[model samples]
Target: MYRWEQRGNLWCLNPSRPLGIVEMIGGGYLAARPQISYRFLLEELAAAGLVIRAWSYVPSLDHQGQAIAAWHSFQHEAKRSGPLNYQISRRPIRLGHSLGCKLHLLAPDYGRDCSALLAVSFNNFSINRSIPMWNILTARLGLRTEFNPSPLETLRLIKEKYVNPHNLVVRFNNDKFDQSYRLLETLQNRPNDRSQILVQQGSHLTPTSLGINDYGHNSWASDYLQRQQIGNFTKKLINWWEQNAC
Candidate 1:
């Protein structure tokens, strides 16, 4: 009864009668195949009566450019005359995981692209921190390797240019790579800010596990736990938005 429809690099889950739409972006590497990497979480949201629009891409060094590209993709689709065109009256909620969180924040919309944003395991790290021995290897190879804005620049940009205040930052207890606290501080310092954080039991990779079936050869205690956490996270997400009704 549930199937993911793909068009180019964008994948969608159109419920029979969608109550709202979720525009999601997954973390690096895994984002290249979001339909499969994020199958479990996306399916849960879809089954809960929400349409899903997940963009697929491999993270590139140019974070800002990628962000712009993603926004345009969604915007262009919405302007088209079809089911993909969300109603003008209701805005969709944007979701991002890890590096995808940075991409969403860097989007050139001033945060007006969605009703609100849900960032899970927000990760903003320098090229050296993100990729082990990156600087050393680059220096030795005489190569120029770095994130376009760099980590510090990213934070500065968010503090100065990001305008939308409605945000929910979720940091799994075990996600050491998450920089939610830092992001929260920046958002809170902004005018008319309304940002919140939720800590739960999970990991950085927890948001990407397929959990395709109860047990499908990849089954293990950790896998089961991941599934449970996925379910838990989904419930919290639905509950939070419904109570706030954004």
Candidate 2:
């Protein structure tokens, strides 16, 4: 039986025998929906004895501040929900995809919140790349505003504020929008940083299911390969969490 509950504004899924906890934040607009790729990932994790708490957020100019507030809120609610709701005796793992990765990394106390963070397809695109060409042009012309803590600003903040060293950054083979390498470099700049990157097979959207479009190639073999790739990635993540997030 699936046990669903609401803790604060986030939704929780309890497995029959949860071994640990995962707090998920999805990328881009998909973050607004509960049915993103993490939904599938969470299902697999549940079968392996894990519970999940997931939520969505609307990105704003003050994304950094918003990220901090959201992280704190998630923690506060998780604690209030009591230990049984999540296996709180064991620290929860942080999982984020695309823009969600940035939000988690930008939190001022990022290192202290979770046991470890798994960031997939970490994206920090410039304003122009994030929006339509016309919108970019308009923003460039001062006719429209752009997201604050821009890509550069976000990187700078990560260098200055983020202290956590245990991070797993994944980038798909053909994900044109991925900026994981950049984030990895910034993280490795810290003398004690243990951040690492994994290159997986598939595209930028391979790790996520946006629910609006088909992912991978339009072939049976392609679909099979993609599924296999995601399965492998999840296995690695679970193993890492068990070894490190605990």
lDDT of 2 at 107: 73
Flag regions of model 1 displaced more than 4 Å. Answer: 81-89, 210-217, 220-225
Give the alpha carbon lDDT tens digit for every residue of 1-246 in model 2. Answer: 455676665767878677777888778777766544455566666667877777667766677876877688677876676756545567778888898888888776766767888998998887667876857578678785556788888888888788777899998888889999999999999768888788877677777643322342466666566556567778989887777654
TM-scores vs. true structure, each candidate: 0.90, 0.85
Model 1 TM-score is 0.90
lDDT of 1 by residue, 120-182 (tens): 999998888899888899999999877988888999999999988889899988777999999
Candidate whose TM-score is highest: 1
Candidate 2 clashing pairs? 19-49
Q: Give the poorly placed runs of model 2, Cα more than 4 Å off.
A: 1-8, 85-88, 134-141, 210-228
For each candidate, what is the lDDT? 0.83, 0.75
